[model samples]
Target: MTNFLERLKSPGDLKCLSLGELKQLAAEIRERIVETVSRNGGHLASSLGVVELTIALHRVLETPRDQIVWDVGHQAYAHKLLTGRLDRFDTLRRLNGISGFPRRSESPYDSFGAGHASTSISAALGMAAARDTMGGSEKVVAVIGDGSLTGGLAFEGLNQAGALKKDLIVVLNDNEMSISPNVGALASFLSRKMTSERFVRFRTGTKLLLGRIPRFGPGLLGIVQRAEGSLKGFLTPGKLFEAFGFEYVGPLDGHSLEDLIETLENVKRLKGPVLLHVLTKKGKGYPFAEESPALFHGVGPFDRATGMVKPSRERADTYTTVFGNTLVEMAEKDERIVAITAAMTDGTGLTEFARRFPGRFYDVGIAEQHAVTFAAGLSCRGLRPVVAIYSTFLQRAYDNILSDVCLQNLPIAFALDRGGLVGEDGPTHHGAFDLSFLRPMPNLAFMVPRNEEELRRAMVTAISHDGPFMFRYPRARSEGLPLNGTPEPVPIGRGETLRGGVDGVIFAVGSMIREALAAAERLEMEGIRLGVVDPRFVKPLDRELLVGAARRAALVVTVEENVLQGGFGSAVMELLEEEGLMARMLRIGLPDRYIEHGSRSELHAACGLDADGIARRIRKVVGADTPVACTPRARFTRG
Candidate 1:
């Protein structure tokens, strides 16, 4: 409704605005976020929800110098808009515009870069300790949500912060949510706020309270002091945090700017660590978000006028939807099958599974370590535990996956959703490295499906197997190939030829099957018949199929949507070496660096992994076998 966004160049500019104008500014920011996000697409509800809080932090604290580290950093969109990036906001999350999350390189205000969750406290503590070491005096505050508080890393940070006794501030942004509703012990404790109170026991103990009584004698004070030890316990419920050795404040009104600003300034002075528990409504300015905040948490492009998001119809079914439907169907037949997620039920497509088997489904907050170990514990009790989690978040539980599940060699199914590049959310959200990490783990089986039908089959195969297994799929929606049939298990550790020829060979995995097929067709048109193989399992490579494919062609190329170093292609290279199928080889995948933010299609095309890139690589690798046009680089490489 207004161009107030132009007037705001930085958080520093807001100092002169009255509280009412500040509140209005919060609305304008939310409006701009909704308007832009509805076209560009981004984390909608979380940004809307944090409007006033972001404003209050800037309004109260000295940033960059003071250091405000946002947990997860997805909610930092408002912070970005306020901190001199509003003019460049159109480039938000686009390649080399401005990142969706805080990047130290992007601006002076972004004190730290973050995309992962539950890491703010430790980061802030580090900065504080650095400040102490440099003898520079500046406030370092960590803004963490209640959802993040559930993660073990956050607690690890909290525990260490308590022991370090640094002058650090941890703002517990408790809307009681972390993608899904917040779960775990800390959230439950924060919600039952201020029902208990404690008397300021004097510097000593109960003796002081009784000693202060005008008529009490010293002899009687001794007896009362002994009783008071147990008496104080009855009144004060949780010094759970105070036990960790820090002053605890709030469970205050987070929306009231005056209260927030005043309370923050007051705690800003208190010595040692302090937790200000500020409660605010998520989706504060938007009515639709207020009504169903979870759905709006990370929204797609939508109509701002009616609050209706346009649906994606490029493909028949999303990979997540297929996975969720398969799990639901399996859970229906098998009573022992259980599900686990790290605070992502709907996002992982386990909503139906959770709804159908509420008793069996465990949404373990943001604690990925706990979820893995918890599933392992369930497996010990003869339950078939399927952990439905995103690929990126799973990186957090590497230790848990190794020590808890893989070490035991239990029959746990790791349903890794969003297993490839997740567009726009950027590098932190990309599912590019699960292959490299999981492949080397002992007793772990890794695989991916070519399409939805194969995914259904893979699910059945995973459930039927007796040891730990993992299956990953892309974030892109399925190619719309119908299920066409019921659940059927494909043989474990086996892959088959999708198409075959004698020219150069292309071995692909997961969603790359489509790319492989497209590349093959392009080659065929150019009189270079290419062989295509889908090695459904990246681990335990289809030895016979791979060797046969290698022998038939003069050159071999392995394709995957993962990092090139020690990934699926590397596995194929090892196979070729062992078999002595010394055909010239080429590798195509992500490089040994962080891929920047952009639309998946744009990144794919630029990296030369799309249909055309794959076809060209195939042509270059098979230069001697078939005469083909080549670029100067390709010609030199071939020569």
Candidate 2:
């Protein structure tokens, strides 16, 4: 058989293919996705689930002219394949390659960029409004998942889109899975197994039957129409969307290209906002993905045949694993310690904790804003609530964190995972701004742990603290250091001297400490003595240690994994200025631009956060000729 996928140049090419040919093309797309993802690693199950839906949409709609905004964009792999990116599909999620999510700059066909969820409907509505204003004849559609509907943002968008009644089509792809199995009332509502198409056809046929029965039929038909609204509400999921001022249609098979194409063609001509509910499996084609959809939701490179992930060289426990184990251990001792996550039970390392303390655990779906305020409410009721969320996702609840938690001085412990340069997912998923944003918030204690043991202690300290506390950790594996005794809370606003030197001092935060120690060791070999200090808390500086180190040294360096602007480095600079220290200072961190997707080590090296990069920068500043081999170690004198 000829390769149908190879013949496709653009979405317009799908228009020429017959229905049988389209089904063949979908199989080819799935094969290509599985082959590429097996080597490159990406969102596997979600993409496979939406292959037919993507192909049908492309076949029916004139894209670039007719905009289709995809929610989250992880499931857009099939969309990417159909839309002129077939050749570049192998480069998915690689450094300097095509993005894993939709990017507007990469292609005109990608109407809007998306990485985060629940923004598609709002974005598509804006595009529809723009098209109306410009008097353009373009159609606008927002392809959102049932899981994304759990977020409040999707409802907010729906509320506005319904009010305006714009010429838009919102396709709700009901696969019943996000990162995990979806939660909350919205999931239950969408999961109702009522056949909406059968009911809709019955309603249509009854209306025609009633209209044809002379004078008495008109009055009877009017009464039945009014009663039909109530009957439809009781029988189908469409009632909820119909109440939102949208013309509700379907509960149709998303895998059926003919049905999808026909429905999409009919809906394209309709005025005002219309919603098409499409039912699809999370992993449609691949048997491995279909069996375990959540595991394959976002995956690493794996064995195509066995579905086993490729093992890394580093066999140490991941920071996520350590955090999960530690949290479970702590929760067992304290009943008041309740955990809350925004639909990230597995991702945030809280799976075991949830299992152990089922009543105390809460997965609040994709609503981050609600999760923060809800944790605050739990704290107010005298519970030690720990909000376990990714650093990037927590940015959505900044206001809730500042006003509801910080301003109220609630004792909420925030366990921020993925605190540094997250690999492969790119700028949207990078936790580069947490330090900068959270630093200025009052009544909040911020901690950064250097190793797995420190992470355990930090968790203990944050839970025990009176005010709101937050600690951030990276996405990498933990240092294989053995955990000693029970975790003990370290002294707040204090730092420890790892290596002592007279030439200069390097204040390193979190994962950067490892790089700092390596750089110090390399400099020591070069006859340049550079001290390394682990400043545990970013908000509360170890004033005495820092001042004394600055007084004795001619040069000082601050290193972090966050963006340079308003970050840990900036905090150190402000401190030195306040103390009136006369030391030449250097800051090493990510630059004030979005870093591209790559391995954590690659990103660290690119941003000069790696040990070799750190050493090269220090050597440039101190001059390569300076010999400090005979210099005495600077003794840290406490104030």
lDDT of candidate 2 at residue 367, scale 0 to 100: 93
TM-score of 2: 0.92
Q: Encode model 1's per-residue lDDT on 1-639: one tens digit a residue.
A: 546668976788778788888888887898888878888878877787778878888887877678999999988889999999888898887777788889898888888899889999999999999999999888988999888888888988989999999998888887863222232223323322221222222324565665777765576887765564333333322266666665666555567776676666666766688877777777778888788778888877888778888988694888899999988888888988999999899899988888888999899999888999999999999989999889999999999999999998999999898787888888899999999988999898888888988888888888888889899987877878867657788787799888987766789999888988998898899988878899899987889988877776666789999999889999998777666555577899988888888988888887778899998877766664553321123222221
Deviation of model 2 at 29, angstroms? 0.6
State the lDDT of candidate 2 residue by residue for 168-284, as single tens digits: 999999987332223222323332322245555676788899899988889989999678566555444778998899987666677877667767777776779999888899878
The per-model lDDT (C-alpha) reads 0.81, 0.87
C-alpha TM-scores of all predictions: 0.89, 0.92
Off by over 4 Å in 1: 1-4, 177-238, 624-639
How much is 530 displaced in model 1, in angstroms?
0.8
Residue pair clashes in candidate 2: none
The residue ranges of model 2 lying beyond 4 angstroms of the native Cα positions read 177-222, 624-639
